[model samples]
Target: MTNLTIIQQSPDPEQVAERSRTRRSIADKIRGMGQNRIGALLLLLATVVAILWANFATASYEAFWETHLTIGVGDLQLDFTLHAIVNDALMAIFFFTVGLEVRREFAIGELTSWSRALVPVIAAVAGLALPALLFVLVAMGSGYKNAWGIVISTDTAFLVGALALIGPRVPGRLRVFLLALAVVDDIGALSIIAIVYTANFTPLPLAVAAVGLVGVYFTRYLPSGRGPVYATLSIIVWLAFLASGVHPTLAGVAIALLVPVYRPDRRDVEHALELARTFRQSPNSEYARAAANSLRESISINERLQSAYAPYVAYVILPLFALANAGVVLSPEVLQGAVVSSLTWGIVAGLVAGKLIGVFGSAALMKITGMGEFGPGLTLDRIAGGAALCGIGFTISLFIVDLAIDDPLAQNEARVGVLAASVIAFILATIIFRISDAMHTDVDPGQTLLRPVDPKRDHIFGSPDAPFTIVEYGDFQCGFCLKASGSIHEVYEELGDRLRYVWRHAPLTQYHPNALAGAEASEAASLQGRFFEFERGLFTDQEHQRPSDIVRLARDLGLDVDRFERDLTAPEVTGRVQDDMLDAEAMGITSVPTLFVNGRRHTGPYDAQSLIRALSEGPPEATPEPQHPGG
Candidate 1:
């Protein structure tokens, strides 16, 4: 082929895509994108209303927002005030979009290719980790202990909206690059909300969420269904999420992952449009008859369905989120709080500092060391500005702050920081880009965001040197014993130095053929000062953790094999195992996994909080409330 015939690139590859943007006139395209800004405007209006209501408006907006509204029967009633309803319920849809965006970016967007993706993905890691560290450093042990999570999340909507105003200065590539970066940032927010912070579980709401999940799978993923009735099922899922003690906004992300995003086939749409016009013609005429014949032959259900579904996703879902959550009351107190608060400092520093140190720093270092490179049209200055813009931490920030700090001052400070950083990042990025007379940067991202290596699931107990006993009874083949890993982990997270878990074999002879040998292996591990490591594997390995696997695990944990072997077959080992089981039996601990919280009994289904409460409350302790199963 002639060099002249070569086509280096086309933004939209003429292939059918979901809500596909046109590459017609760049200026016109930007303008069209602006129309999409209705979502931003709606968000802004909501923020304004919320702020005015919170600070100055006559009625207590704060009280109205925070007040619980109950639904259903006594004790069965779902209690959530206005803020919770909006934050958890309506926000689920927002999370669904987040899920969709994350999915799509990985599927085809800038995140689809790794070489191009290295910079942003690595940068996102830096962006997420550093800000989180900064917040933790400042908030921990303070009233904001619950709020360490507040600083880590980056709000993409607010970030992008800021970018929009910086028009002509930011290039298309920068926009795509910043978008990919921020989307990953959103995922980080999700991780923090799910893992680092959560309250004790309550059953009803979680049960609702589970049922809603069932409904979603039946209609959306199951083959035996009609098209997803996203409305009713969506509401059900939202309700469940609200009740589950989980921030409900995540429900949106869950739905987005499960919801289908494909546009109806264009060819099918064309054929159906023709059939609709013909259907308008009279029924009697021969031409009408022919039209009817053609129409019957031409139309497809999927095509007609697509036509109906297009408008809802394009207009409704997103705009609603913006309207509900985007209200930022601009007043002197809010502004002053931003200046005086550590949340404000942490946020501004984390973003301004983190993006610079994390994204740009890593990118530059990687490039210099021959490890990574930059997206097209991006200059160092632009990158710096882009980093600043990423400081936009609204939606996720609000969600985290809700969980992180229960105190009013800290929460308010966090809110102020989120608003101010978003605004400042937007303004700074706009100014820098305008100075260079550039608009948007372009990038061909090539990889996906990297999820962290899952930590050792086995419970890590008392440090390498400590003296406390935790007797864990087990049958090698028992399912509960197999499931003990997570249970042990919760305890460890709650009580680190005060205890260590010791394995004992109560192996119901009917269930475990080698239970005796398993206990011996654990005893052997103790001989080599690596019993804890061996116990962790003994519990966590999903498959057969045979006596031999215990040896292998010990070796991996740096045990002295010679001593380990000698201890495994020690004469008194089997009896030691039996004695612990006898103690458990006498205590009426019918369960495979149970804990003695400083000589107090805690049986199966006991989490950290329960165990802690059980320990403290035992021996003339206060009456304990009923335990929530998962909580």
Candidate 2:
């Protein structure tokens, strides 16, 4: 206390500013872990812990996960073992994330069109059918015939984790193919659960679930506080599904599909930003809370909830699930029986050999029939490697074991088979990927332009006098570009007036139909000094970008609607759009979200740290001349 009494703090504002900057830098790094690699590592760790605990402390492992728990009001109490709770309740959240990912892919990702989705859809169907056929053939007269669904579904988490372990040598497009295939596989798994695994169907609870979903649909339009409403409706749907005899987790998917993917109106967005700016300019507790609420209301509920639940589902729910379900007590007798069990052989053959054949064969058939062609970097060997990785179906396989097979012996045998097959798949995929990596030579297409900022023509933000300028050539309809917006905002926040951002259009018109219209809308808004506002609106609502919608957004943003409409159709505005496109073509910038920091092309990920590093290092020694004037 005596020593503390003499303590003093530095009055230098630079030191205080330096400390704040350091804290923000740390925060940026932490927030940049959205790639889910850490989640995969955590899942792997949980699985290892489960196996060690099952063998070393058998009684404790069983007793902990097997403990019964009950919750409800009055006589409406529901009871379940800890294991059941993890599977039936917590896993619903995980499944909800999967459903969101699926919806997002279908909405704006590579699967947005039939041309892109066709091969994956066919492959997934074949992937499911072949495994089931193989399982039935292996277990035909052996009584475990109905457990075919156990091997049909691929475990997204485990497969992704194994791929992540293979490092950056893997092609990006191949990863997209596997992820899309897994999503389609999940759809098939849900169909199987609904049709094949249900013991009985009840009309009352099924109807109640439908009503609960309707409530969720209406809640999307709520002016404020939709979270509690969604949570309540989700619970009702889950309970009804549980009583209806359909697997309860399917409710999560249904609810996720119902979440609104559209952005709020421009009035709401402007008001929300005003509130936020007011709070920042003059801090007060009331203003702070109001700004927070307003900002939350501005974002779509789907995005808000996804960001909120992603970490919890990834780290806590999945790790706990792995710990509870991955344990297989391998006694001498159990091991001997598992080695010879028809169920074990059926699962092993179905997952490993069956997945490889089903995935690769179906893809070949697609190419051979001229129904679909391979994506970029997806050669025969890479596809085969990805197909092998698809066999690592640990999580979902165990889930189906609990559903399709009632016999404990069969369950244990199936678990053992799943564990062994996953290891085999990982090893096989790694070797194949390594070989493919060595066989292929990495080629750089020499894209990404190093161009100076043209303040007069560009849609600009931040101080005009800033030393560093960040240029982003991006499309409104591209999902990755939309994701990059967050990273860009973070960098803007950290650098403040030290940095400026100039946005240029580089829409992939072949992929995004509304991209041209969106770009014109942004240009029109810029004539009224609302370019950033309109651009943000377009990015937030990729699905709702008709001409009428764009005009309505401008009108709501306090612009003169007639003037906006005139500017939207003006030849000069159209010329501006084409000018950016011409620049993109000249620079060989084929992809959206290409960036330049301080006149040097930034090739790294558009995350905060990477951008900051590029900025700190400054531009290259010689500045390349701008390809086009006023660009």
Best by TM-score: 2
Pairs clashing within candidate 2: none
Model 1, 1-631: lDDT tens digits are 1011112222222111211111121211133345435555656666666666655753565555667788887677777777666666656655666677776566435565676677788888888888777766654544454465666666666566666766444245456567778778888878778666756657788777777777765674443234446667777777676666666677777766654443223244346556657657644476565555444434333233334543343355444443344444546776776676666677666655665567777666776777654533455667766777777676677666667766666666777777766677677777776765543224211111111111232223556332333445455555555544445555555556554554445554434544555666777676655656666666666355544566577778888877776655443454345334443333334345444444344432343444444444532333332322110
- Models 1 onward score TM values of 0.55, 0.68
Clash totals for all candidate models: 36, 0
- Residue-wise C-alpha lDDT for candidate 2, range 504-618, written one tens digit per residue: 8876665666787789889988888889999888877788886667877887788999888767655557656755664554454646566777766666445565566667764
Alpha-carbon runs more than 4 Å astray in model 2: 1-35, 167-170, 263-268, 280-282, 285-287, 368-370, 442-631
Which whole-number lDDT from 0 to 100 does residue 486 have in model 2? Answer: 67
TM-score of 2: 0.68
lDDT of 1 at 49: 64
What TM-score should be assigned to candidate 1?
A: 0.55
Give all candidates' CA lDDT scores: 0.56, 0.75
Question: How does model 1 fare in lDDT?
Answer: 0.56
